[model samples]
Target: MNSLLIALVRALRSHCWLRLLGCAFILSSLGNGLTQVMVFGQLLRWNASPGTLTFAYMLATLPGFIGSVWGERLCRKMSPLRILILTEVFGMVALVFPLYGLLSHHIPALLVIQSAEALFSGMSYPALTLLFKRGLSAEELPAATAMETLIFSAQVLLGTGAGVLLFNVVSPLCILLLDALSFAASAILLLTTRKKFRVRDAQTMAADFPAHLPLHWKHYSPLQKRSILLLPALAAVGSPAMALLPALVQQIRPEETTGLALPLLFARSLGQLFGPLLLSADKLRQFSTSNRRILLCLVLFLGGYFLLSPLSAWPAVSLALIFSAHLASNVVFALGTFGVLQNFTSRQVATASALAWRGQVMVAGLATGAAGLLAESIGATGALYSISLASLTGVVILLWRYRT
Candidate 1:
């Protein structure tokens, strides 16, 4: 027990950027608490339809892509911190969001504000991620990740408790005001911690086109370019699944749509709580680090998808299973993608990561909208079947790649 405690302490102390990022994360956590329990819940009260809610989820990915592409260029020209601060200011204006809906009942305006929030996210993530990368030694990366995950988990736990508390009493407008203050304050804290960052490589400066590269693919790597090429498919993953819950409830139990749906979030969040522990295990480090663990995660995801498919018709049990699938997929995706990016040519990591994120967003939008259309045509069950088959097919392809 002492040895384990010492190891964690040593890992935290060793990484300078880790501490700064930790502080930043702490602030984001507090703000996120206000957003989720208050603003988002309020949106539900404001009559955000299931489809619109899916669009909001889709919007979450959009700004990040835009920011990432633009952020890279900006990161090269000035400090990423400065750009992040600009976003912080922009986000502060978002405090008026509740008013947007309150005065006019303009759901579109609320979504626009949501999109702006995402844009700020897009701008900040790639920059902030550098802190995570630089904060730990190669050997301690897992520990560093573990600490980070613990922070996020704690944040959600605290935020949820607080949100549930605050939501009952105050209007979402009050919560939005508090969220704005929290973010602005976080920005200030991050700015104060700015000395912890330094340019790590030439790539940290800007993304430039190689003179020898093809006209069509001048600014990105072949793999990265390919990832972008696959954006439509990737983004679809979340939209369908996330959006499905509303109609799933509507179909399964008409009167209790709101109440029963709570389990999906609860189950998902609970499953996620177990993720960092699994990834941080000493046993996992001994097992395999290359690609095997990630491949295993994908395989688990496929299985989970199949298990939770709507065709199973066991609502409560299937929801739990599907939540597990999501948690597992997120764990694997984080580990696999982080491993890959860490190995990327220094100049391309941010650019490639951005593109990959972009792909995720686009695919989420496409997936949700597609699920909606398909549900309209065949039903939610048919849509789930299709996605399940595709997820399994992806697993097979990944395994084949692992072999060859």
Candidate 2:
């Protein structure tokens, strides 16, 4: 018992700061999620008009579009830690930037605020990715991913609970204030880590920046180039699900929208947990290599979607099935994502991650925006079915080319 306790203590102390920042990053991210849900879910309360909420959501996505173009420049010169601290500080500013809308009743100001938040978030993901790479080894990446999913799981669980509890208890600005404080805490932690690492690099802003006259697209190997090209497509699929799901639920059962939709959200997180465990338990690899496992996971995931769509009456059951399928899709998606990512990059992880995230955000923003609008018109469930079917079909096409 004493030995077991000591071992547990040792494990807990393993790479303390990296783990800490990773955890804090999630907490702040959760706060962001809370703010977004509270605001978007109750858009009518914010003195909003029809389709304005949807527009706001899209505005929040614009940063990624711009982020991909410039993110790599910053990552190349700055430590991931520094990049995180800077982007998040800016993110806090972004979160608060919209208060003027409520204060003066200016719609355009609020739109700008949402855009800033998305922009800062776009800048932060690459830094986070770099930290994840630095924080874990090849063997530990799966566990690192588990921890990540767990943090996101808590975001949904905790943030939703808080958003609900505070709906009448506090103002949205109050929630935003708390997000700011979390950012401050995260920045402090990052500063401490920076001092500890004392990483001194010569990379300068000007050197890494896209040149004024012309941008130099770095030469990439065939596989690497293919991976970069594929990034936008893969991200497009992953980005749209959350924004669209609730709208879909509303279409089916407006009365039970939150209850039906939130649980489905939980199910995706739950599925993510289960999907990773399957890999952690060695089940995913029971078939073959990482590549093989990824393909199998995708194939099964698509099948899960087929099973999901046909269940007409049991919306609850259907939600669970569909989310679970998505969960498998996410796992393989992450596996394929990171597996390809780690292998694909010739540059430092930070720069590569920045480029990749930029691609993701660019594609994800468009996909999510489109999905949200489509959900309002087509019935959320049907839209999901079409997306699932179409996405799977596209994958089959890509895989055929992959074989050749």
Candidate 3:
């Protein structure tokens, strides 16, 4: 743990531009954490049904597909720093509609504005990945990525807790205002890194991307191929369970509702922040390569889901279980992503990052839509159980085949 921290510190200290970018990321993540809590809280307050939440989530995420298509091309054409600035500027503008919605109590317009923001997010994310790939050396990637994930996750943890506290005491308009300010702040921070970034022409980009890159699917060893194929599916399985959380709280803890929702969200974010740290330990690093770690984390997730299914009504127990489940899931996700970022060529990184991101968004949107319908048909608890059980069975089959 000390070693990993030392490495992270060294990397950040050595790269002034990266340090600036990290600070910017921190501000953005803090705003994002608050936005998640505020948006859902407002929707529930406005008497939004499960179906409405589902549609909103779907609309918000699915638009990323279009944005990603544009983003892939933009990342190639423009300097990533330039793209990041534009996205943040647009994002700040996009928040205006939500701010207006809060002031005017216009639900439809709020939903539309929120969905529109996803487009900028989609474009910006790939550009962000390109920046890291171009800026850092290959040796610096794993630690840098780990540090980035931890920072975002930690900020999210603080953000959600703060959001909950502020929600109880303040107006939604205040929270939205802060969220907009975060975007503007992040953009200003990004602008300072201009000297470190330059637009690479087509010849330079092609020279960076080798024709016979090992990132191709057919080029991977058997185990690596299986891991790559299963990563997306593993990630997708947890989405529906997460989508059900707000409604589950409403169902099992009607008295507490939004009060409990924020804490549960906080627990999950806490898990995400710490999970990679666990795997970064020297002893755990051995397990990281053999697939044992991934399998164990998957089991942990399944076990937590099963237990939480029956006990979602108990606030304390549910918080712990949700934390453990998400922690395990994040570990698995981080491991797979680390492998990709470490191995991928600079040119391949943007495309792979965009595709992986787009896949997650589409799947989460669809899964949320499905979960909403299932919750309406059965109870939330039943929906949680059915979805998790199916996930476990699928993972088990996948692992069993990989073992052979």
Candidate 4:
């Protein structure tokens, strides 16, 4: 842990842009985490069926995949700073509907707002990736990513705990207002620091495009391509299980929904918090030679879903499993993936990042939608087991294809 902190400090000191981006990400993550809990709670309060909630999640995330394609194109035409600022502004605007929905008590408006926010949020990834690829040295990327994971985990802890507390004490509307303000603050910080960073078009840096490969796919190597394609499968493995959490909680303790769920959220956040420590720069370099470790972490992550399904009758055990699974998954999937992408040349990183993110959200949406249907038909436990098995199959395939 101390080594992780020292590495983060060194990475931040190495780049002024990283410090600026880190500040913005902190605020953005806090808002995102809080809004996620608040929105899920509100959906439950509205008596939304599992299918409805998961469908909404699917719709909200689908646009992100499309937006990611556009983001790559935009990266070539505009500066990363401009794209970031514009998307941030759009994100703030997208929140207005939710803010109004809170006052009007309209569920549909909130759903629409979620989808709109996702659209704007998705577009920001390419620009952010470009910034990281352009600004940070190869030596700094792993530490920088670990720092990001740590900050995000901290925000998840703060946001989930505080949002629930505030909702019970005050009103959900207050939480929405706070989330909007966080976006505004993040935008202001980015705008102010815009001039301090350099923005470059990733395409301009490439010496030549390969004639044999399709133009759009020319930037990625075979391993990078495999990595991007596998992201959705990895994402699908865990998303269904997570999407069914509210249903799982309601099944175990109907009256203590928020109370019981908060612990699970905290456990997940704790996993995320400590998960990145294993991905410190030195550790990442040590592990970069093989994908075997990542595949193993994913297998454990999926195994947790199967474990969780049986332990719903025992909340304590379920929570413990959740923590362990989430911690392992975050380390292998989240930080490990970023570390792999960072190994790519600067010219390839932005496109690889965008494509990987696009695949993740797209598959996650589909997986969530499927989870809802399965939960409605076969119950939450069945859905969890089904996704876990499916994810485990994906892991086996990955292991066979990408052997150490």
Candidate 5:
């Protein structure tokens, strides 16, 4: 942990742009965490069915397909900084719908908020990723990513816990308002940083403002293509957990459905917080070269979910499983995302990032939609088990096919 902190401090101190973007990312992630809890918590309060909860998640993410295409065009024509600022601002405005939804107890308002936020998020992802690729050195990238995950998880931990506490004490409208404020805060920070970034690299900015044309898919090596798919595949498999959580809670702890949502999220975030820290240590570098280690973590990641279906009936045991599952997942996520980003060249990064994100959101959206339907038909536990088993089989085939 000390080493990780020192590394983060070093990275932030050395890079003015990173410092600004890091802060902005933190605020955005916090808002996301809080939003998850608040949205689901209110839905549970209304005695929403599993299908409804999962459908909400599906609507929130599926629009990213369009947004990614839109963002790609924007990145080709506009500055990344401008793209980010606009997306954040629009995202902030979109939250008002959710706030009204909470106030009026209207489901469509919530649905609108989900679709709008997802679109803006899709638009922002490429810009955010391109900036990181352009600004940081190769040596700095992994550390920065680790630090990013750590900060994201930590803030999410805080936000989820706070959401639970705030849910009881404050009105839902107030929670949504705070989330809007976070978006505003993040946008303002990005706006200020835009000037700093320009001053530091005016020439580079002018030369690279509108990125060059993307390389054709045929241009990428087989390994590079596989690397791009890995994260999205993992995400598709794991994405059902959040959408299914409300139902799982209501299933196992029917009397305490509202009470358990945040705790599960908190546990997952806590594991995510530690995963990067643990992996960042020097001792872990040996395993970094071994495909066997990747497979091992995959087992933990998928196996945790497989077990979660049956064990979710026990609250304490379920929390522990959630922690372990996400811990393994964080390792896979970091490795997989970095692998995709690193495979592309500077000119290709924007397109690659956009495509990668598009794949993730699209797959995850579909997976969540499937979970909703399955849950509606067979119940949440059956849905969970079915998804987990299918995911486990799919992953095995993927790894085997791609094995060197």
Candidate 6:
């Protein structure tokens, strides 16, 4: 742990630009965390049925799919720093609609605003990945990614807790305002740090001339293709379980749903924050390949889901299971997937990251929609049991195919 901490400090101290970018990311995460709690709580307050809320969430991802389709071309045309700054500017503007909706007490307006936010937010991801690929050395990439993930987890943890407390005491509108200000602050940080970013390699810049979006399946090995395709399915596995959280909370403690939900979220985020630290430990890394690590995480996720399905009557136990599943799955799934992605050339990174993210969003949307319907038909526990079974099946298939 000390060695890992030392390496992280060295990386940050050596890379001034990384420090600036990390600060921006921290601010952005704070905004996102605040908005997430506010939006979901508002949806419940507006009496959006579970099915309706899930469907709205599904619809919100549609624009993200569209954004990913064009993200590659956008990255090809603009410097990543420029793209980053521009997206932040657009996101702040997009937040205005939701703020207006909150003021007017209009549900439809809020939904529309949420969808717009998803679109612009989705567009920024590829640009951010490209920046990391361009700016960091190979040795620095893993630690940098780990650091970013850690920061995000911390922000989510702190922000969710704070958002909930503030919302309870103040108003959701205040939370929304804070979110917008955070975005503005992040943009200002980015603009101020622009000069520190490395120049794009001239040769790589020249290669961007191909007008079409640049996915060439022929270039990837079969294993790589399988990994990419399965990533979305892996992501979809947890959607049902997560989608049922509000309903589950209501069942456990009807009046305290809002009060309890954020803490549960904080638990999961806390797990995610610590999960990557395990990766940095030489003892763990030396014992397993990335694929093996991912498989183990999947098993843990499946176990958690199955356990939670039957233990819904026990909120404390269910929360513990949720935290464990979240911790393991995030490290194995998200970070492990990115580890594979790093193997690709800079030219392919944007396309691969965008496509992979789009696939996850699309599948997660479908899963959430289906989960909502299932919850309506069966109880939330039954829906969760079904999701766990499906996930177990996926894990079995993955294991057989990889045979690692």
lDDT values, one for every candidate: 0.56, 0.57, 0.71, 0.70, 0.74, 0.68
**What does the lDDT read for residue 37 in candidate 3?**
74
For candidate 3, the per-residue lDDT at 189 reads 89
Model 6 agreement with the true structure over 50-156: per-residue lDDT tens digits: 66666655655657777776666688887777777887787778777778778898777777755775676568767777777777676666655566565557556
Q: Against the true structure, whose TM-score is highest?
A: 5
* Local accuracy of candidate 4 as per-residue lDDT tens digits, 1-404: 43555777887887676788778767866777677777777877777777777776676677888788878777766777778778767777777777777779888777876677567667777667667666766766666567657655855676776776776677777787788888888888887667677433334434322323333666556555665665665677777877777777766677777677767877778777776675556666455435677767777776675676557678789788888888877775554456445656555665777787788897888788888889889887788778767766775676467543
**Model 5: CA > 4 A from native:** 1-6, 150-155, 205-213, 281-291, 309-314
Off by over 4 Å in 6: 1-7, 59-62, 151-155, 198-204, 207-214, 281-292, 309-316, 402-404
Per model, state how many residue pairs clash.
Answer: 7, 1, 0, 0, 0, 0
Query: Order of candidates by lDDT, top first?
Result: 5, 3, 4, 6, 2, 1
Regions more than 4 Å wrong, model 2: 1-12, 44-57, 101-114, 132-140, 143-157, 199-219, 222-231, 281-319, 344-346, 372-379
Write candidate 3's Cα lDDT for 1-404 as tens digits: 54445556777888888888888878876776677677778988887777676566666666877787788778767777888788778877777777777888887767876577678777876777777777777766666657656655855586787898898789888888888889889889889876654443233566655556434556655555443434455656777777777777777777778878788889988888777655553433344355566667777876776676478767789889989988888877666566556546677777776766677677667666777788888977787777766765766666666552
lDDT of 1: 0.56
Candidate 3 ranges beyond 4 A from true positions: 1-4, 198-206, 209-231, 281-289, 396-404
lDDT of 1 by residue, 275-353 (tens): 5455543443332243455546555555565455444456678667756765665564445344433444444544555
Clashes of 1: 7
Q: What's the CA RMSD of model 1 in angstroms?
A: 4.9
**Model 2 C-alpha lDDT versus the unseen true structure:** 0.57
Angstrom error at residue 68, model 5? 1.8
Q: Among all windows of ten consecutive residues in candidate 1, which has the lowest summed lDDT?
A: 226-235
TM-scores for all predictions: 0.77, 0.76, 0.88, 0.89, 0.91, 0.88
- Candidate 5, which ten residues in sequence have the lowest lDDT sum? 281-290
Per-residue lDDT value at 377 in model 3: 87
Show where candidate 1 strays beyond 4 Å: 1-9, 36-40, 46-48, 143-161, 198-239, 280-323, 379-381, 391-395, 398-404
lDDT for residue 301 in candidate 2, whole number 0-100: 59
Candidate 2 steric clashes: 1
